[model samples]
Target: MLTSKQRSILRSMGNELEPILIVGKGGITANTIEQLDQALSARELVKGRVLPHTEWDTRETASELAEATGADVVQVIGRNILFYRPPETGRSPRIDLSGEG
Candidate 1:
């Protein structure tokens, strides 16, 4: 679980990131989950966008994607969504959430 402070920090970091993952009218799929899993492993923080025509709303899409990829939802603004996950064992996470300056 992420603390409010951690989520805040991630939200700030997400503001500058461009959306790399896109959810379309197809909604969530196995391939989409796989891609997001790979992204989480590599980047820890990922930004995604849901097209306006999708069946699922932005918040629902974010929730499903986050659950599917085992990532935390950092924020969802408009069509953009931010996700964060710690790297697998033996790998280093890209974002630091220790709350130490």
Candidate 2:
């Protein structure tokens, strides 16, 4: 889990990144979760955007995605969500975890 400060730092680092995936009107489907799981494994940190037509609340969507993917929610700003997971190889990762690391 990331502390508030770590989340803040990650949010700032994530600001320059474009959303790699977009959840459309279909919302968070099983396939989406599966894809997100893979994405988190490969990238560690990722950003996603929610389309305007999505009926789910942004916070709810972010939480659901995080839970489904077993990732931490770094931040949810506007329609965008930032997610993070440490690499599985047990190497020291450069992810700014603030004091939480």
Candidate 3:
């Protein structure tokens, strides 16, 4: 679980990141989850969007994506969703958050 401060830090970091994936008419699919997993593994932070025309709700889809990707929700602003996961094994996470105990 992420502390509020950690979520805040990730939000700030997310502000500068362009959405890497866009969920469209298909909603969340196996390919979408695959890309999310790859992105999270490589970058630790990932931002994605649900197109306005999509059938799925942004927040619900965000939750689904996070669970499928094994990532934590950083934030969801508008149609955008931000996800984060710690680096795997020896891979170093690029973003550091304070207030860790």
The 0-to-1 C-alpha lDDT of every candidate, in the order given, reads: 0.90, 0.83, 0.89
Residue ranges of candidate 1 with Cα displaced over 4 Å = none
* Superposed model 3: Cα runs more than 4 Å off: 99-101
Once fitted onto the true fold, the runs of candidate 2 whose alpha carbons sit more than 4 angstroms away are 89-101
- In the order shown, the candidates' Cα RMSDs to the true structure are 1.2, 2.5, 2.1
In candidate 3, position 84 carries an lDDT of 96
Q: Against the true structure, candidate 2 has what lDDT?
A: 0.83
lDDT of 2 at 50: 93
Tens-digit lDDT track of model 2 for 52-98: 87687888998999988789988888998899988777667756565
- Per residue, candidate 3 scores C-alpha lDDT tens digits across 1-101 of 99898888889889999999889999888999999999998889999999997688999999999888779988988899999999887876677776452
Regarding lDDT, does 2 or 3 come out ahead? 3
TM-score ranking of the models: 3, 1, 2
Pick by lDDT: which candidate is best? 1
Please list all clashing residue pairs in model 2, or write none if there are none. none
